[model samples]
Target: MDLRVSLQALMGRSLTRAAVAASVAAGLALTGACGGGGAGGDDSLTVGLLLPGGGASRFGQFDRPLIERKLKELCPHCPAAFAATPDPAVQRQQLESMITRGVDVLIIAAVDPELLRPSVEAAHRAGIPVVAYDRLAQGPIAGYVTFDGAKVGRLQGEGLLKAMGAKARGGQIVMMNGATTDPNADWFKRGALSVLKGKVKIGKSYDTVGWRPENAFVNMKGAVAALGAGNIDGVLAANDSLAGAAVSALNATEVRPLPPITGQDADLAAVRRIVRGDQYMTVYKPYKPAADAAVEMAIALGRGKSVESIATGTVDNATTKDIPAVLLPSVSVTVGNIKDTLVKDGMYTIAQICPPQLRSACDKAGLT
Candidate 1:
């Protein structure tokens, strides 16, 4: 029942599929019943799912399906509407549309937390509760669900330091952080800095715009030119997309023996890059638990029930304070534990990670 202790335990070990499932089950049990109460016996409840991206993105490939599955499992008759876009304006319009549609509740992963504030306030005024999913949204949100952002950054910092080895002592690394628009980006940067500040010198730090790979590529290119590619020892990329861009930029500059890079979101491409020695490591935050928590919170809020039973903690945004929240633990993934963590947890398979070109590398990494 002690969330801190449970999260520490989860972070201390490489998680298998069964272990992750058990953790989710235990968390659900804390709420009494997984399918308890909703808009009129769950038969007439209408839910809206709003995401930041779709089609090959994490939201499209994993979070959306997992949330839909959980919604079906908990509320069989609850008809759900879905929309995804990377534009904050479009997302706000979608949120407004959902509000106009008079849905019982909404689960939104805001593209720009600040930009979506007015829309979230509108949803509140409309008497529809909004459950902030993944990214924290501003305004009177009923509940929130996401991975522990601080821990995710710490894992990346530690992983990068380990990969750097002797170079870590006097090494200069570039910090390619996420967009300034996302509060989670700041959370992650602060956490990484907590571990990285006293140890290494940050030669160039950039807040990538829109969390876009192209933007990260431009920033990394600038860093490589400013700091000299040979002088840069490591990179702390906020996510896999940025990590990939950093690698491309370094490759373009002819930086042979690519320096170690830390990344989050164990995207399939990122995993392949790890196998190919292009990236050092990535943080893997299981999506199912987050999705399940969001759905449960939406249902509970729809039925005029408190999410105290479902929420493990509380979080505050610029416009809201003491919002009930469930912050799940995340795992650090590298070539060394890819099998034990991601593969064992069914996030990916050996064949999917090891293609023909990577077959030999996979064998060397013992992923075969």
Candidate 2:
């Protein structure tokens, strides 16, 4: 099969296929040779995949396996090593080690993109092309794969407003944003603000440090105290982890009439929360295409082939301009589409989400 045709078929949507195949026609020939321990041009490529910590669960549970499996399928002997941690410095060290080990390509989901710049630059200096995964790292990135961050935020904001109904205008809501270090977090905040700034009163807003649930819990508690439980009508949590924290704070404070909360990542627990009427909605980014693209890009880069064929568009990073990228679309998952979205996608089974204790909620939502 033509690499270009295979790349197009890897994704589900025709629009995505069209966007990705545009540049493939120009870069059809494979140029790299195979031999040796280094990226000094060889197919014996060692691909290093560095992911952000297991806080979100998706990185380890889905992205890692999917990328590894796809790499095996694409290149039989090409080895892929993986690592993850919450600390930025630790991740940077890991990247440096991968570079020292002479991996041909590096795919990184930066723990802190800004702090990780030096290591990424080191990889570039060592002639190893780095592919920024999920979050756009600040460096000379050759390729990137992620869903539209701003769009994800817009979905969350729009869902929150719809859930709030008429109370959205005068109602007060807390904004629980992700860590400032993450570029995507800012994108999400900007997108959410685009929709929410004029429509509702932002009673209290916080940039959750480290994207940590404990930090979010503390921030939510402070928001409730500063704004008063009654004044707050909703919460715009950047992701499911933060949403869970906000819900915990609300429940612990015994706040009357829990407000609608928005989340991203569509975590299993978050989906369950939606079924139990605790969370309003979550943005479901299909993991397959993103992971598959990363692997395909890695293999291609390892084989000394251009990734223009795989990347749908070009994105500018802090230090790089016109970096090839694959930006996937995100879907809004609410109780209404739990069956069609998560279940249909095989992300989770009804039995997994609807526990025996929550059988009644599941029945009401028709998840049985």
Candidate 3:
């Protein structure tokens, strides 16, 4: 059967609850059957899930599995093909490979959204619809799924400024942003700058490439060196990874009773650091809705159907026209409401965050 014809046939067959449950079971049962992501059953449609980094644990532990299961539910016979490459060029290569393998659709959370435009365009040329997942991809995309990045950045900046309190106007802040390649990184920086530009004196700024904690560490050291240890009152670290790096670098210097530091992702380590007063704030974008949205859109695209059913809005990429986009909101988490943002959302259990060492801190914060 030809690709489009086969996809049409699959779409014609409406999914039933029983069949979806069976498909979910089959997908979960046959884990390693697919190459890269998952590919096995003859009737199973393949979706290439391309994530940018291995450093962010959510992509693997949460996003990958959830997306796989949801797609399976949508198409009982289809299994997923998940591949996450750390290198952007390798990611482009993997995309081409998946297209060559006749995978029905492509879902990418690009390392470099703009840089991958050519690759995404290539996939569209092959008649494979591409969905920009998490990280916005700059090509003619069918769909996109991610939390509102600008809002996340604004929340981070506001949280930091609030923590700084009396010094909000006269304080000196160092800005350490995420990798330059990601559109999300730029949006994050833009949002933070909107709130921070008029509020504080930006002593120094650096864009941490690859979102690597090490790069953040190096950049942070430069900021402290340029601004002086005692003069810098706040630090805007884009995500939890960079925040941790910045904090570590800060401690190595004379800075003590750490200044307010902003972060996002609410990673386990970042939460712990927040408890310790090393980091003041972080943004929490719940992963479940995002995972579920990607799965739904991927299945529809795989079957050559409209993603309009699941999309919340439309977003335009540099090279792409209007693409269906789902923008989930992010919440700011502070020492005062860690339980509300993380615990209440079921993102983390108190047991996981409030270990024996953090038990007292959790109690003090009324986290228990």
Candidate 4:
């Protein structure tokens, strides 16, 4: 199938629970029967899952549950221990704690890859395989699963340029980027620059601290102060959180015409913002495939099997080279295609996105 079609299908409504359970039962049993160290006979196996906290809400709302459910379905007797915290130090401690508990395998979404390097290395030394999820943790990780970071940025950049229209030639845009500690942040910046550089004037740019909306708010306020709100024709916000902040700052200054803003994560609020014309676009990356890949990789590694079957490709990180990976695609969402994208994908229903106050806006956008 075409890549775009496949991505659309992946992002659409997930498989039913009954279907998933049936597949897991048959497939995993077959895997073990093939003598590839499948999940069978691993009654005492333990998997450690570490996430980067609930900042995005997707982690807790979708990824964690999907991963846990898949793990249980695939390996009926294997138990999983989960940990999530916003602080990098806390994440490191959690890694250490998991290590001390002697987990068979670990799936970690590091808050800061560099700071978590030592912990990952220690896990490697302890013979515990680590699967990097979302953000690639710098270490000898066995597998990695996430969406294409650069593609995500390119989508944002393209959306911003399109929204700017005739103003694109000399448009001034403020860039509200994610935390510098994230490797994906660097990739996103590079991809965005590939489209934005030379084409538009970057009035102000900031590396948002901690990926927090409040920090983005402060940074955006600083940008507006430095560039003058009128001078900024557009804003390139790395994610929904930053986009919301940029919009908030613009509102505070009471800019007559709100500049078009680009965002990612297709967050519920951001989608609502897009529908309301407060923001331009966002990138939607389905969580099911990513979480599902991580679970499969974790279980396979824990069973002393290779993840060659699950990994779609390989990626080289700062400390590791040619690591197995599965990089999913992302879709750009705009008001024009809200139904085709988010609603069709079942990411959100019309009712959820269109509250009573937004009813008119939803109808106007053909979302009703």
Which candidate should be chosen as best, given lDDT against the real structure?
1
Q: lDDT of all the models against the reference?
A: 0.83, 0.82, 0.76, 0.81
The digit string of per-residue lDDT tens for model 2 on 1-368 reads 00011122223221012332323222211122333355534447778888885434878778877777777777766777666777787677777766666778888999899899998988889888889999988889898888888788899889999999998887889999999888888889988999998899998889999999999999999998898888888999999999999999999998978899999988999999999999999999999889888888877877778988888777787678777788888999999999999999999999999999899999999997
What number of clashing residue pairs does each candidate have, in the order they appear? 0, 1, 10, 0
Specify the poorest-scoring 10-residue window by lDDT in model 3.
Answer: 1-10
Q: Candidate 1 has which clashing residue pairs, if any?
A: none
Give lDDT for model 2: 0.82
- Of candidates 4 and 3, the better by TM-score: 4
Off by over 4 Å in 2: 1-43
Candidate 1 residue lDDT tens string, 111-216:
9988999989998998889999988888899988888888889999999999999987879999999999888898888889998987899999999999999999
Model 4 pairs in collision: none
**Candidate 2: how large is its RMSD?**
9.4
The per-prediction CA RMSD against the true structure, in angstroms, equals 8.9, 9.4, 8.8, 8.6
Model 3 lDDT vs. the true structure? 0.76
What is the per-residue lDDT of model 3 for residues 1-368, given as tens digits with 9 covering 90 to 100? 00010011111101112423332222222232343323333356667777765435767766777777776666656656656756676666666666666667777899877677887888888877888888878778898888877788899889888999988997999988888787788888888988988889998888888988898888888888887889888999999988899999999886877899999888989999999788999898788788888877877776677877677666666655557777787888888998778888777898989889888998998878
In candidate 3, how many Å is residue 89 off?
1.4
Instruction: Return the lDDT, model 2, position 74.
Output: 72
For candidate 1, which ten residues in a row score worst on lDDT? 8-17
lDDT of 2 at 210: 92
Prediction 1 TM-score vs. true: 0.90
Between candidates 2 and 4, the one scoring higher on TM-score is: 2
TM-score of each: 0.90, 0.89, 0.87, 0.88
